[model samples]
Target: MLVDFSAPVAASPAEAEAAAVSAEQVGYDGFGAAETKHDVFTTLALVARATERITLQSGIAVAFARNPMTVAVLANDLQLISEGRFRLGLGSQVKPHIERRFAMPWSRPAARMEEFVAAIRAIWHAWATGERLLFRGEFYKHTLMTEFFDPGPNPHGNPPVELAAVGERMTAVAGRVADGLLVHPLTSVAYLTERILPTVREARGGGLDDFTLGLSAMV
Candidate 1:
């Protein structure tokens, strides 16, 4: 079994980095950092600088708390820092956090997340191929990208994006737009087979060739 270590959400950056180092030494296939107490990207960046092999992921970075351009930049930089070993894990937090804590708009979360991922991809494409940044969606708009602000194509290419899902609508969105799906630790086998898999299968057109399904179990 391919095992991954999830850094404690309560751990500080230093603690997480040390844990990640130990995880790598012990032959963990991957390490995931959460976005609870500290910035997930920041913690992962430290972990990335310290480790060489184990894949790094933001167990979840709140997608609604930040814009797509910022997220694209962060993920791109992390991919470079980790030498192509980075995976961007994004999630749309609950409405209270989105609206009150983050002071961001909250409506049609599934649709918004799909557009968010699309916007990030559009920005990366613009940087990679000098394409115009013209992604105008119902929730986000980005029609400008000047050379002065562009970082250009990354050497490691863009990192793969994974989305966390509980509901079928969000799961469908994840299947449609994300490279993978992050299954919650609370997900039951029955629920996965009956609800999640069916939704993803239908959304993915009955194929999961290039898709990754990550389940967090409390083994």
Candidate 2:
């Protein structure tokens, strides 16, 4: 089992760096930051510069707040900076937050999330393999990727995407596309086995041997 550490909320960059180093020194397998007051990517960038071995992750970054291209570029940059120690953890917050808090449009979260993930993957594929990006989804489209805008392939390759989901549709999407699933803290083992696992298995059309499940629980 891999142990992970979460950086505290509203922490300064120095504090984030110290937390990451401490987690690494204490032998944690990974360290992550959530999207709260401080930007998740900025905090992780500081941690990436501070530590060398421990994995860096945005524990839950609001996906709808930014477009796929922005996420792909930032994640790729962090992965390169961390020498492949980065994992992009994306979450689609509720509609109210998406509209009122982030001032971003929100609609059909499950379908939008599915398209969002596909778009990011397509962007990375174009960057990595020089493939033409023609991802045209109902919610997002990416038909342009000039070499001037491309960041090129990272020596470490593309970073893995982990999605956080509580609903069945989003969970199925996670199983279908994401490398990992971030389970909500309110989720129970019974629910995971009876609902989440079965749905995920059906979506993937088999066992989940290669997929990682990140569970959160409160005592």
Candidate 3:
């Protein structure tokens, strides 16, 4: 289990960096940032620069707000900057937030999120292996990658992608594709055993040796 620190709303970047440093000194395994008034990536970037050993993650960055290409670039850059200590945690916000807050399209969320993850992985694969960029999904398509644009492979390899899910469909998608699952804080143990675990097991063919389960709980 990894302990992570989330920066509060009123906290500045400097304060957040200090908190992350303190968390690391106190034996926390990771530091995370939520996409609230302050951007998640920016906060984590600060933490990444300030802390050398602790892992950095975006607790729940909105996926629809940015395209897969943009996400791949940011994650790759952060992975390099953090020396492979970054995990990209993404979430599909509810319809109102997607349409109104992000001013982005709202459709089949689970399907779109699955494609989003796939597209990002495909982009990373293209960069790491020098493969042709040819990922075509229902919601996204990418088939162009020039040497001028490619970042090439990093010394630490590609960053892992974690998906935040509450519903069974999304959970199944995460089980099928994501490296990890970020459980909603409101979830109960009973719900986890009865609904989430079973769905993920079915999706994963009864194997979860490499899958990480992350939960955030209130005191």
The candidate scoring highest on lDDT is 1
**Highest TM-score: which candidate?**
1
Clashing residue pairs, backbone N/CA/C < 3 A, model 2: none
lDDT of 2 by residue, 1-219 (tens): 787888776777678889999999989999978888888898888899889899998889899999999999999999988999999999998998999998999999999999999999999999889989899989999999998898888899998999998989999999999999998878888999999989889888978988888886442
Off by over 4 Å in 1: none
Candidate 1 minimal-lDDT segment of 10 residues:
210-219
Stronger candidate by TM-score (1 vs 2):
1
How accurate locally is residue 3 in candidate 1, as Cα lDDT from 0 to 100?
A: 87
Q: After superposition, how far is residue 61 of candidate 2 from its true place, in Å?
A: 0.8
- Write candidate 3's Cα lDDT for 24-73 as tens digits: 99888888778877777787788888899989888788999989999999
| C-alpha lDDT (0 to 100) for residue 150 of candidate 2 | 84
Candidate 1 similarity to native, TM-score = 0.98
Error of 2 at 154 (Å): 1.3
